[model samples]
Target: MHPVSTPTVLVDEEDRIITVLAGRPLGDDWDEVHAEISTLLHDAGPKVGKPRKQERRGDYTSLSFGVSYGGGQRAPGNLVQGECSRTVIRDISQTKAVQRAAGFMNGCFAAYAPKLYEEYRSNLSQLFAEYPHLEQIFPNSVFPTATFNCGPRVVTLDHVDNTNVPFGFCAIFACGSYDPVRGGHLILFDLGLVIRFPPGSTILVPSGTLRHGSTSTQPNETRQSFTQYCPGGLLRWVAYGFQPVGSAKPALRRWFEEHHDERCKRAVGLFSKLSDLQQDRQAVFSLKGSV
Candidate 1:
C-alpha cells in the first residue's frame, strides 16, 4: 500500500473535484477499529444470495432508509418515499459496531470533501426535518443509506450508481486484511486513475457520475468495503416540495422545468476545487460551522 500522507484530489476539466482519495486517517487505533468492524460483518454474514454481474464476487447487504424512484411504474406511482432496510446486522451490538465504522468514515468525508459534505448534511437535514417519518440508519451518519460489501472476496465491475445523487459524493471505507499493492486498488475508469487503497482507508467520490470498481485480492487475502450514499430521489422530493413530480402543482412543476439547468449548475458548484481546499476546510471546521 502506498502510504498517503496527504489527500490526492481528482478534478475534471472545470476543476470540479470528482474524487478525493483520503488516506488512512484513522489514527493509531485503526487496526483495532478495522478488526471490530470486520468481526461484526463476519458474524452478520452475507445478506444477498448470489453475486450479480456488476458485483463480480462476494455478497453484500444494503441498509437503506430514504426515498426512491423509478422501478418502472406510471409517473405518479413511480416515486416512493419510505424506509427500505435490507441490512443483516440487526442486533444491538452489531448495529453499534456498524455505527462506529460509519462515524469514522463520516469524519474523513468531512475532512477531505468539506464543501460536498456540507451540502450533503444540509440536504439530509432538510429532508428529515420536513419528513419526520423517514428513518435514519445512524443518527450521526450524514449519508441517508449504507451498504456493507460483506466479502471473503469483494470485487466489483466498473459501473456507476445511476440512482444515487449525480453531483453528490459517496464515502467508501475499506476494511479487512488485504495487500493493497497485490490487489484491492480502486479503479476510476472515467478519470483513468488506479488508486492503491490500503485497508482502513476512506475515499469520497462522485460514484453516481463515474465508472469505478476495485481489483481482486490475492490468494489467502480478504477485502471488505462499507459505502454510504444518499439516493437522488430524496433530493428530488425535497425540490418538488416534498411530493412526487406528477402530483406537484402545475406552477411548481413549471418552475422546476425552467430552473432545472440552473439547479444543476449550482449542484456542480458545491464541489470544492483543489485550490479552494484550505478555505473550504476552514469554513466547515470553524466554530460556527453548520457541520
Candidate 2:
C-alpha cells in the first residue's frame, strides 16, 4: 500500500485513532503467545517505574518492561499525574511477547502517520549507525522502545501521556478476556467516546496530550493491556546527543556535559526539529507538532 494511502483514524475529530492497524493478530499460536506474555508479567512482582505515581490500592497495579522514555516527571492541568523514580528493570524487552508488542506498534506508526514514522525511522537509523550495538539493544523499536505494560484490572485514571513525542501517536493493544460493555473500555474523557477495545485489537490515542483511561472491569472479567509510547524526551535525546538535555537537566548535568556534542552530522529528515526544518529547508509544518 502507498504510504500515503494507508488508512488512518485521524485525530481531527476527537483526538483519537481507532484500530488503525485493524485485524492484525497479536501473533500466531495463541497458547504460546499467552504463555510468553504471562511469564513476562508474572516472572517478577509489580516492578516500579510507571509514568504516573498511583496511590497504593488493590484496584491498580502494573509492571512496565522494555526501556525508559519521558517517565518519572510531572504534568499540569488535565494531566497532572506526578512522577517519582523507582527500580528500573528491562528484562521484559528480551521476552518474545513484549518484542512482538513493540513490533506491532512500530508498524502502526509507519501506517497511521507515515511522516512522523519516517522521522522516527531516520533518527533511529542514525542511532544504529553511530552505535551499531543499538540494533541489538532495541531490536524492534524505531524511536523510543515500546512501554510494555502488563497488569490485571489496570484501571488507568484519566491523564495525558506527557512522555510521548508531540508529533507521534501512542499505540495500544488490549489483551485478556474482558467484557467490553461491562467494563474495560478505553475512555477518551474529552471526546465522550468509549471504545469497545476487544482482545487482540490495536488502537491509537494521542496519549501525550489527550486525557484517557479505561473503565472498570466486571468482577470476573480480567483486562490486561499492552501499549507502546515514545517519550518526547526521546526525540530531544536523539536531537541533543543520544542523552537527555535542556533546562531540566540539573540532575543529568554530568552526563549531558559528557555527551552533548557527541552527535552525528547526518542529513536530518523528519527527525530534525520542525523549527530548524522550516528555517533550513523551508518546510512548513501542517499537523507536525499539533499534539
Candidate 3:
C-alpha cells in the first residue's frame, strides 16, 4: 500500500528549483531490493550480456519493460519485460514488465519482486498531485516506469525522454555506494542545474520534457539507479477513449489542436505548486544480520 502523505511544497536550491521528497524510508526494503539486483550485475538478469544494452546510448547496462505505442510504422501492444525495437517512442505506461522487474528488484532473477514494486509505487504515488492531469489521463491506474539500471561507475550522456507524456512526472530512485558530493549527480541541461543525487533517494523529473543525465563516479565505485517513466501517447490513449491518437476523428483532432495553448497553460499552473523536497544521502550498507 502507498504511504499516507499530506502534500506540501519544499525546494532544493542547490539544484535548479527541483523538488526533493521523502516518504517511506529506503531502508525498509533495502535488503530485498539489493539482494535481487546483485545477481544481475554479474551475468545480466533475464537474458544474455549487452543485448538489452545495445539499444541504449550510455555505458551502464540495464533491462526495461512497459506498454508502449508508436514509432515509424509500428502499432502498440501489451509488452512483457523484453527487448523493445530501436525506433520506439510512443505510449509507455506501467505494464506487466514492471511487475516482473519489480519482482527482480526484491530478489534473485529466479522470482518476482512484489515487495519492492508495491513500495516503489506507493512512495511514488504521493507526487501525483503535482500533475493533476494523470487522474483524468490515466484514471484508475499505476505509474508507468523504466528499468533497473546497473553497472560500475555508470555515466549517461545528456538527453531528453522524447516519448513520455507531457507534464507527467517520472520517479528515479538512486542506489549503490557512490559518493554524492564528488560524483554521481543528475544534471538537467536545459535548467543548468547540477543535483547532488544521493544514493537511496528518489527524485521526480518530468523526463518527457527535460534534457537530463548524470555525472561519472570513480572506477572502483559502484553506481546504480532505478527509474520509471510515463509516455505521452498514454495520455492520448486515455483522452481518445483507450485508443491510439492516430485513430481520433478529424473533427476531434482539430478541436484538441485549437485548444493546445489553454491545455499547456493548465499544465504549467499545476506544475507551479509542486513541493515536498527531500535530500536522502545516507547508506544502509549490509542487511545480512536481518536476513
Candidate 4:
C-alpha cells in the first residue's frame, strides 16, 4: 500500500494502480472534447433541474448530478426516482454525450495519465471476468455518459451500487477543485477511507464493495464529477432488459422477496403502527376511495 497523501493511491492485494507522470500537457485533442461537452451542456441546460429534498430513509446514497445520455431517456428519470434530489443536467442525446465523454476519457488516457487509465481498464477487465452479464451491454469499450454538479446543497449520501453485474464503475472528476476540509472527498465506508480528489482526478472503485458519499461542500464551492458504468459481462444486458428472459419474473420476484424481506418487514411494521393510531383516534377523517 502506498503512503497516504492529500492525493494518495490505495492498492489492496487485489487492487491495481496506474500513475500519470506529471508535467505532460493534455495536448490539443482535449480542446475538441471540451468543446463538445460544453455544447452538450449548453443544449441540454434547460432540462437540467434540481432534485427535491427528502428525508434520507434508505441504505443507499443520493446522486448529486445526472445526465440523460446513453442507454436511453431512462437516466434522468432514474436519477429522480432514485431520490438523488439533484439533477445538474438532463435530456441530452445519449449517443452524442457518450461519444464526447469517451473522447475526453481517451484523451486523458493518452496523456501522462496513462497509468490511471490503465488501472481503470484493469479494474473493468477484472469485473467483467466476475460478472459476465456486463459483456453484453458494455461491449468491448465502455463509454458512459453523465453530468456534473457541486455546491453546499449538492450531496450524495453513503451507499454502494447494486452488485448484480460484474464490473466496477469509474468516475472522472471534472469541472471544479475539491477541498478535503469542505467534505467533497469520496468516503469509502467499509475501509474507513476517504479520497479527496483534485480537479481532473479520476477515481476507480469497485462499485459493489465500496460504500461512498460526497460530504457537504463549502458555502460557495462546487464539485463536478462524471461517472462511467462499465458493464462486466452477459449480466449487464440482462440487467438493462436488452435480453429477454422467459418466465423469469417469478424467479426475480422471489429473489427480491428473499433479499428484501427485512425492508418489507420494516414497511409492514410502520403500516401497522399507523393503522393502530388511526383506530385509537376518534378524529373524523375523510376516507380515500381505495382505503
Highest-TM-score candidate: 1
Position 145, candidate 2: lDDT: 44
How many residue pairs clash per model?
0, 3, 16, 16
lDDT of 4 by residue, 1-291 (tens): 211323334543433322221111244454344344444443332343434554241222223232122344322122233322332232332345444554444443323223233334444455445444332222223332233432213456776765312223344543343354555666778778765654344554555456677665576654444555433322333343433333346776567567676744532232112223334222212331211
lDDT of 1 by residue, 1-291 (tens): 334447777788877677887776536666777767766555444433433533432335333333445555322121232222243434422455567767867877777678778877777688778766666667677887777666766787788998888988888988778888899999989878899988877888888888998889887887777888877777777777767788899998899899989988888888878788788889877865544
- Please tell me which predicted candidate would have the highest lDDT against the true structure: 1
Candidate 3: deviation at residue 50, Å?
1.4
Tens digits of per-residue lDDT for model 3, 1-291: 322423222333523223433322433454344434333332242233454344444866665545455564243333444343211211222333223334332322101112222333343354343333333212222555456665654576887778776555566666556677889898888878887766555566667777889998876777766666655665565566555567779887888899999977755433322221111101111322210
**Model 3 residue 81 lDDT score:** 41
The TM-score, computed over Cα atoms with residue i paired to residue i, of candidate 1 is 0.84
Tell me how candidate 1 scores on lDDT: 0.71
Query: Candidate 2: where is the Cα deviation over 4 Å?
Result: 1-23, 26-59, 65-92, 128-138, 240-291
The residue-by-residue lDDT of candidate 2 on 10-67, one tens digit each, is 3443332332534344335643564456455533335543336564322444543333
- Pick the winner on lDDT between candidates 3 and 4: 3
Ranking by TM-score: 1, 3, 2, 4
Ten residues in sequence with the least summed lDDT for candidate 2: 76-85
Give the Å shift of residue 39 in candidate 3: 5.4
Is 2 or 4 the stronger prediction by TM-score?
A: 2
Q: What local lDDT does model 3 show for residue 252?
A: 79
